[model samples]
Target: MVAFALAAVFFLALCLSAREDRRRFRNAVLFGLTFISLSVALLLQLDKVPNWVAYPIVLAVFAVPTLGTLALGVFLIGNGVTMVRKEGRRPANLLSMLAGLGIFGMIALLMVVQMAGSRVLDGIVGTLAVIVAYISFLFLCFLGYAFLYGRIRVRGDVDHVVMLGSGLIGGDRVPPLLASRLRKGQDIYEAQLARGGRPPVLLPSGGKGSDEKVAEARAMADWLIAQGVPAEHITLEDRSTTTEENMLFSREIMTADDPGYRCVVVTNNFHAFRAAMMARKAGVNGQVLGSPTAKYYWPSATIREFVAVFWEHRAVNLGICGLLIALGTAATLTT
Candidate 1:
């Protein structure tokens, strides 16, 4: 009952928060609460089941961590291969692979310590385990909520469909990643038109890079025009390099045309939540929409986005990490 109550409260809070502002940390908090509630409910139900059934359930619960770790490691390694083959061999592309290797290394080291019968090593491992658990819990919260947030549907009429930009290929050509955003924005426009509403303007948002011969926004606009979208309906926000600037500069154009403008910002699925948060911060009065990305490419890209989010809130993250370490150390000493 207590667990269910907590679940209800959290769900209500999630509804309120999502309605008020879907692009905040409260979404993560509500998700964590819901997970905890469901876990407690499952445990309670298991306690009433027959021993034969309950025992296997308990065993499965205990086995999940090991199975999940193994599966994640394998997936990351495979994703790394795909990234290299499809994208490039840059250091940024190696994150998923390196993370997979690190997980196995940590497990191996812990197993070695368990066999060596060294009290000091055990103590160190115990402390490290707690810190790792804390970080892992936070990462789970982020991953789960981001996935949910990206699935939200933007309804009603929109004034603009803003497509955030990525780097161009060959100094001016639209890359697959950026092309995906453009297509999504175009889809939103078509959807509105089909609903008998006004066809929204498409805003391709990005500035020129040092290596690029033209502004990314202009290139994106050209790509959209080539796709059969009318040239008159495209607005080029060609002065913003970063995501923050993408939202801000685009908002300027949106507001200039219609002060009460509503829009949907489009990006790849993995980047949707973070970009929505940036849009909220920049006071862009719109939701975010996501286009499909390659399955194998998602892990590394999601990790890169997660790292950016962590760094963006580093002070709070670092403080929580420091507290977790201190608590872990104290627990280790006591035991």
Candidate 2:
């Protein structure tokens, strides 16, 4: 009953926090806690249930982690191979494959430690296991919350639809990835107009890269213009070199015109949540929307995004990991 009550509290907190500000990373933590507390409450009541129900639950509790990890490892490995073949040999493209291989490697290490029975090996494996578990939990929280955040609709009318830019192909042409963002932004703008709301400004935000012939925002603006967006409605912000910059510079332009402007920032689906976090940090009054991404590319890209988010919060993450390691080491030594 106490566990169930705890879960209820966590759920309520999660709902309130998410409602108050969907961009907060704390919302993800609350969401994860709600799920975990509920799971624990369920497991605690298993003993009072019928044997048939309890048996399957017991089997699942033990079997799911191993089986799920194996399945995930295989899927990521396959996706990684596809990414390498279809995308290229870039390090970014190899993330999924490397993560998959790391899973397998950990499993093998566990097996070897079981056979060796060395105290040192046990301590090392235990430390690694705890760290991995912490990271995996955080990743699950991020993945689940990101999915939920993506589904949320923009409330009321927005004054601008800011489409974030990706690198151009041929140093001038907008690639399919970036084109998707422009299309989504246009759709939002048209939808607002069709609904009898004011037509929002279309703001394409990015800068020229050393390898690019023209600024990314300029290329994106040209694409939008060709698609029939009015020159008067288009605002180009061609100074941002990163996602944080995209939000900050776009905020400056929007706020300059109307200090209390509301807007939506657009990026690829894999990047939407992190971009939202950046928007909040930049003091932008906006929600973020995601454009569709290629199916084959999403896993690696999503992993890359998670890595960035993890590093962004590295101080707390590393502290927790270090504590877990110390505890694991102490336990192993004492035994």
Candidate 2 local Cα displacement, residue 228, angstroms: 0.9
- Prediction 2 global C-alpha lDDT: 0.93
The TM-score of predicted model 2 comes to 0.97
Which candidate wins on TM-score?
A: 2
For candidate 1, write residues 130-200 as lDDT tens digits.
77776677778789899889879987999999999999999999999888889888888888999899989
lDDT of 2 by residue, 122-230 (tens): 8899799889988998998999999999997897789999999989999999999999999999999999999999999999999999999999999999999999999
lDDT of each: 0.87, 0.93
Model 2, residue 260: C-alpha shift (Å)? 1.2
Off by over 4 Å in 1: 51-60
Please, what is the TM-score per model? 0.93, 0.97
Over all chains combined, what TM-score does candidate 1 have?
Answer: 0.93
